[model samples]
Target: METDGNGSMEESRSKLLLYLKLAFLAMEPSNCLLSLAIEAGGGCITQQVQNFIVKECFAKNMKETTMNNQAYIKGILKKVIANVESSSVCAEDCLYEELAHYLTIGGPPEENNIIYREISFLSSDLDGKDCSNSVNLVAALRCSSNMLEGDTGCSLWPSSLFLSEVILSHPEMFSNKSCFEVGSGVGLVGIALSHVGASKVTLTDGDMSSLANMKANLELNKLCLDVASDPMHPCAQKVECRHLAWELASKAELQDQRPDIVLGADIIYNPECIPDLVRVFSILLDNDSFGEDKREAPSAYIATVIRNLDTFNYFLTVAGKSMLSVVDVTAKTQVPNLLPYMRSYDRSSVHLLRVSLLSE
Candidate 1:
């Protein structure tokens, strides 16, 4: 039996290699062989073929079709992500070779194009299965950091499950509103918002590395940042990457204007930053006053994979308390209570808590 098992493992490895070769041979420059690999139960095989094609593209004079093919392979990877349910095509160093070149070589500039991005969901490929249980939204966003943070599942706000659910549920919330995402790591949520027409979106993150990446992603997607500070310009919907730390988010930095929507993902994991996060919320939400203009008070959304429920609950409790206190401190409007703002929906270890001044 031991010998038989070893033989089976070797056979599986051989079949995988054979299928990978077939997939590579089948994928002509314009043909749909890429799709065939997906249909042939060749998720891993497709990945290998993709890697090879990427490398070949780089070796063969740094072609433009390589970038287009990168997008194509990404589409297949999305299918692979959906099929596998728990594997990551984004290996630690396995960037689509074509995109790596574009990032390093630079692409066409569009300082006047609309920028769209999504935060952590699945990799839009086979990786989606890993977070199948969480709520994800297809939020359109505007920012340059869309390309900055690509460390697979590491860093802040890296998953798209929760954000996708939000955008699908509340598309109108961002349709014409000016949206601003704090700590827009990789500009996922912010970019998705821009994709769906948020009117104007701003992606804010503190890391310079992430900001540079965001710019590359924006350029890759045919979006660009404006040279002047014109808010009403046609390309205002395009994403802008700027450095912003929650601790330093003051009137001087935010320009004293609260956004119609404020969003964060995976920001609640750190208990030490809770106070700073709350303070940033207070200042950005105009002291948490929904007032008569519920639209004006800045609807806030946060999505986190609840690896630790204690941390999740802690954030809910803190958000509730802070929002109520802001209400009392800002105005005498005794409109809605805080407990009602703390309703939650659960999905396994991943929990969705809607915390705001508005009663659901």
Candidate 2:
């Protein structure tokens, strides 16, 4: 019985470690952190768990970026301290020391905060390799504290994360292909495409601020930004950033783009925008003029989280009317969970659709 009890405790601790790691990676809210810490401590705030939160999570996060919300960190520490006191557990000295440090530093900067996220992908190398063989792609993204800023394109959504994982997991599909992404928020998917050795990558967003932020992120990652005279031509540099509003984009301009693959992440939300979005898709995916080489035609991979049934159905209706066929390939395709540490990202909520122009 004592041995069984010991095993149970060990299992709980293991689970706690996973929860803590995920919470830190996903940058969960302060309240969520307090709850996770409590769970890590077996329903109480333990001193050891407090130390882990301070030394492992908070300290590491602070060092990773100067743009981190110091006030938010301080608040989380205070909550942890209060929880420890309430639970009759003594909090670590480092927690108080960090809280004092934050008090001196004051709040985060007024500018948008930049977060460096390391997205790891488990390598498909089947040479009897272990989990340690995974690869990490680090991206520097500027995101607003408020979710609605930059037309909501400045925020990192779960759909983008899911799409990025799909790209990384299926490198063969994107490698050496010319890929274009619409509504490329934060340019996470663009970075992923470059990592997978895409021959040419074009990232476009309708929002000016989002476009600027995406360009900054691309520059931060040291990926060259190519501005081509002909948007249809393959980019001279590995990545290209463009200001493309679906509603405003000219049909001639859309027809000029000759990408082999098209991609979008979380771009199917607005019901009003569905018509223009599908119109853009129609021009891009219509390869009847390019001859009957099916392999040469562009295919679209859209990752979207269906928040409203009406909005999604409306998109489908608009797409079908635009001579586009949308197929749900989320189950058909085996996309590995590359970002296992991102607990905040509900990949299950995202659905991958394969879109193409119907045969003439």
Candidate 3:
């Protein structure tokens, strides 16, 4: 009985450690982290658990995301230490030392606030033995410190990450096709599209700051944007960045850009923007509007996290009224979770919708 109990305790510890690792990777909520720490400590944080939290979780986050919340992190550490001491468990020395260092030296400089993240996609050979080979895409993104300061468009959202995975997993779908992305925040999806050899890629955002940042990121990856030109012609440039506000975009302009595939990530939040967004989609998907040749209609892949039921339903209703068909193709078009290491990202929360024009 003693041996069995020890084995059970060891199993629980192992599971808790795994949970902590995942929570750190996914950048989960602070409350979730606190709960994980308590659970890992078996209701009372021990010296070893505190050491792990400081070394593995906190240190790793600081390095990866340039997280400079010294005060917030220090508070969490103090709470944990207090809990451990109150429970008569010893706390780790290194945890207190790190906290003291933060309280003294302060957080990272405001200028160096941006974080550079490396997203890797593992590739396997036919034998499936050499699965270690992977492709890495690096993105320079601003932290979500201030959503009101146009930071919302500069931050990398989870839906964008999921959409990037989809593009990489099924390169054939995008390769040799003309692709255009709406609300191209941080330009990760655009980068992925270019990686898969999309014939022509155009990334557009309503926010000028986001457009500028997106252009910088594309250049950082050694990709050049084509000279700004008429939207009617197929982009001769490898990648193009355009400032396009859906509310102000004209129907003629949207119809002029004959793209094979339209893409968007996390752009369906506001109810007020639904009508304009659907109008843009309708014009883009109507291939017949281009000429009498009657080419195959273009399809759109929109990756969204439905936070509000009413807003999502409103989008569906508006889209349907605009003669657009929206289908949930998430299961049918499932892609490999190439980013298994990204625990902070809840892949299950993202839903993929395929949108096209209804047969007329």
Candidate 4:
């Protein structure tokens, strides 16, 4: 097909605009459009059109763009948002924290803050060796807090790094396994399981407030999901949420289900709750034959970025014989060093450990 000069110029603009829209859509779309607006290169387009759409969307009290239309609308708006990275405005801690802030159903940013998380994975498709992908997920537990009140600073803590490093190192351990994550603050690892096609994923946290926030973020990202039955709806994954407390760890059986894999992130931070967290993992792992997919020999993968060796040792000591092996997961690339954002007392202080379970 031959095109005239005007057609060629229009096509060029279309192509450039297409990339811009894709970038904005990639930013979480279900929540609010403030991030989307920031993503769409806010003032680039005919300012009148931008103002018209924003005003209309608000005038109608439309909270978010639907899942089915999100990518499409974003694609159309590409001309507006030219820079993909800018569309992903929520990159640094401030913006990242803001995205998380809206995803959380309730709670203040002071308690539920976002933190930089590092994760590495062993790719079977890549010849069974480890590859690393660093992304952020939410975490409820803090390294220095027992006060579990309405604190937004507690949104997504740095502890998410520990969880990500573990999953990245031992991706297979989670594959085809029924996984249940306790205290799933931001659910980074739990969502990661669904990404790898795990048998099932259930994210639980004691804090109802955090759980609500986690669910919002999960739905917002479409991370761990199943399809919506309605044709009018988009496909989502299946990730369940539950309220659980470590003090009641022994009551895990009460849920009437046992998970093949039990995971936690930054759950060992509070020294006072160390025993409870250990107890929770123990109960979740004790019955190997409980879940539907009872394998010949069941295993587990625990990832942690511990700043305090004493605390790490404490978790290991409390876990006792359950800790079969430990491998330190190192970053494959230095381009995105996690330490800068982690701000650990010692740069090497944040250790990513993979603790395997004893075969049962």
Candidate 5:
């Protein structure tokens, strides 16, 4: 992540505070948060950090959060006190009291597992511009606790996070361009595209439940949902979300969308879906004009993590057979790491693939 390393001490502390608060809101592990606190305290968890936690982070979260994820917060408070005690420093009394309150609140863990994650993309050091008023873009989303349960699309993926950084870092690439996304999980990339001022965005997913959740997340980010079925009474929203099964996607349905740019995050993992995916891409990236001269084919940028070599190669082979060219642009692309506060996300592990038609 591109951090403000050369900034003044005050700026560094401000970043620490922001990072800590964002980590807490993101439900980061307590140990990860403690490390940030210790750095802010210059080797110890100071009384000032304690007060900030109690007054701003814990207090505000407790009061405003409607989710039943207090268990996570309770764990954080416990770890904070432990850290302070280990360092031979006395923690603020209010911190202990906050822990006590969480002790009293009890409920079924399963019922209140759903939560809204505030994904913030800090821009202070993104482009070397330090404007306090112009903070990062925070996209609030309602996500399920069990990401791998019935609906995996409801969960956030690291590739999406990486892709988000790419979109925010290089807004020029997406701004004023017609963008479409495949497997729009949690609708994070779509939100990033809209933030970058994409002229038109069309997001599609195969799963019905995920499609519903994607719409909700888009609305949560203040972007209205536009369905492709209704063209006459279109809303003011520039972003559109639709359900599209790759295996069932017809050529006509695919031809209707001729975006300047196509995007996907973590959509190439499944080996079973590669064929249909390549088919969809082939149709989408094929020549859109009927004239003798062929216009520029729409390009597709796909972000993925190379988990298994076999699966990755399978996707590449399938794309090659479908007359598509895929370039490994992970090192070539310059995407500023806007989400440094999110310690859980490993930006390096994510790779970028620049894909487009290789001439019919």
Candidate 6:
């Protein structure tokens, strides 16, 4: 059976543009992009497709595409043009010039790669219907380039992604609530909190560098940093970043925040940090209103990837000692798969734990 040429062509266009959007923003290498190009051109990189890529995709961010990591762009462009020329398709002069520019100013491997990730909360637009022509936009994050380094909050973890999805899916739980996040990496969850109308959002990180990076990300998203001082400003984000080393953080300081809700992402990896983390929870959950209304009891929603069972068990034991109830609500809470476009994010890898104070 032969498929209709027009139907096939539309499918090709949709996939090509969809892949290009992913490629231009948050892709790793050019392998997927390369395959998409060939597939879109009906088994070869046609001159039309070549012009589309060079003119449409790579032309957008000249500085980001050419600078900092000229070597990275140079390598990708080299392979792409080689494939095109091999297929007997005449490559464009603009592509040749772009290649020349990178080859002339090649440098060492890029320590930092600036990435713009566009997350969409599409419900059922998966069949290429209403997907290619336009995107149902969500938050666009300027992820830190320094995420390559180990042991830094500069990276975006799956737990954070899961937590963000949870916040977006269930805005009622956080709206008008004072929210505090421990181990807030890159401030993605804070941004989500702001989106969901959290009355106050305070993000804390132990690492100084990661805290600075998180501030930059918030600014990139146009979220106000110091909402307390800039209260009158229309763009006040009600989001602030703080240096909170769990081991050294004082109970007096945590008590001052008086957050109604506590959030954490991927903060359960280290056994050493469990004691301080549980202690921080205890202090944050300690509120005078508990005597009056049990409904006012603060809750901690922790999203973590259980890498080690023993380490997670240690957290449970410590939380129990601190009179905290840790319940696994990953199954009961049905959070919409908001981030269906991000291929790298695995929702199943993350587990959501609801923690609350237990009566003594």
| Model 1 lDDT per residue over 1-360, tens place | 112576554444443333333333222222343343333333443465445444532243224433333443444444434433445544323444434444554434533222322222222222223322332322223333223434321132423434644554456767877777776765656666776678777877766766765665655555557646555655554567778776766655663545777776667777767777877766666633434554544656665676777876676667777652322111221112111111121322333333345333
User: What local lDDT score does residue 164 receive in model 6, on the 0 to 100 scale?
Assistant: 88
lDDT score of residue 43 within candidate 3: 72
User: Which ranges in model 5 have alpha carbons more than 4 Å from their true place?
Assistant: 1-7, 62-66, 106-109, 124-131, 226-235, 289-295
Residue runs of model 3 more than 4 Å from their true location after superposition: 1-113, 124-132, 148-150, 226-236, 292-294
Candidate 6 lDDT over 111-211, as tens digits, reads: 55555554544443355466643443355565555655563587778899899888877889999998999999788899889887899899999998788
Q: Candidate 4 on 1-360: residue-level lDDT in tens? A: 133676554453343333222223232232223333332333333343254343433132223333222233443334233432454332233333333433443333454233221222223242122212222332222211223555332344444544554454456767777778767776666656776667778888887767776776666555534454433332243467777877764554533546777766666677878778765665555555355755444334444556687987777777665545445544531213322222231334444544455654
Specify the highest-TM-score model's number: 5
State in Å the error of residue 44, model 5: 1.4
Model 6 CA deviation exceeding 4 Å by range? 1-12, 35-49, 62-66, 69-71, 82-94, 105-129, 132-151, 226-231, 235-237, 288-295
Across 1-360, the per-residue lDDT of candidate 5 in tens digits comes to 234464666666766877788878777778889988888776788999898887768655644353456777888888889888888888788988888888887654665557667888888364334534435688887777777566678888999998988998899999988898999989999988988889998999999988999988887776766445544432345788889999999988888787788899999888999999999988888775423645566899999999999999999999998889999999988777787778888889988999988865
| RMSD value for candidate 3 | 6.2
Q: How much lDDT does candidate 5 score?
A: 0.81
Q: Pick the lDDT winner.
A: 5
Return whichever of 3 and 5 wins on TM-score: 5
| Selected candidate, larger lDDT, 2 vs 4 | 2
* Model 4 spans > 4 angstroms off: 1-154, 165-171, 223-237, 252-255, 288-294, 321-349, 356-360
Q: Which order, best to worst by lDDT?
A: 5, 6, 2, 3, 1, 4
**Weakest lDDT window of 10 consecutive positions for candidate 5:** 227-236
> 223-253, model 2: which lDDT tens digit per residue?
7664444444333466888999999999778
lDDT of each: 0.48, 0.77, 0.77, 0.48, 0.81, 0.77
TM-score of 2: 0.83
Each model's total of backbone clashes: 48, 0, 2, 31, 0, 0
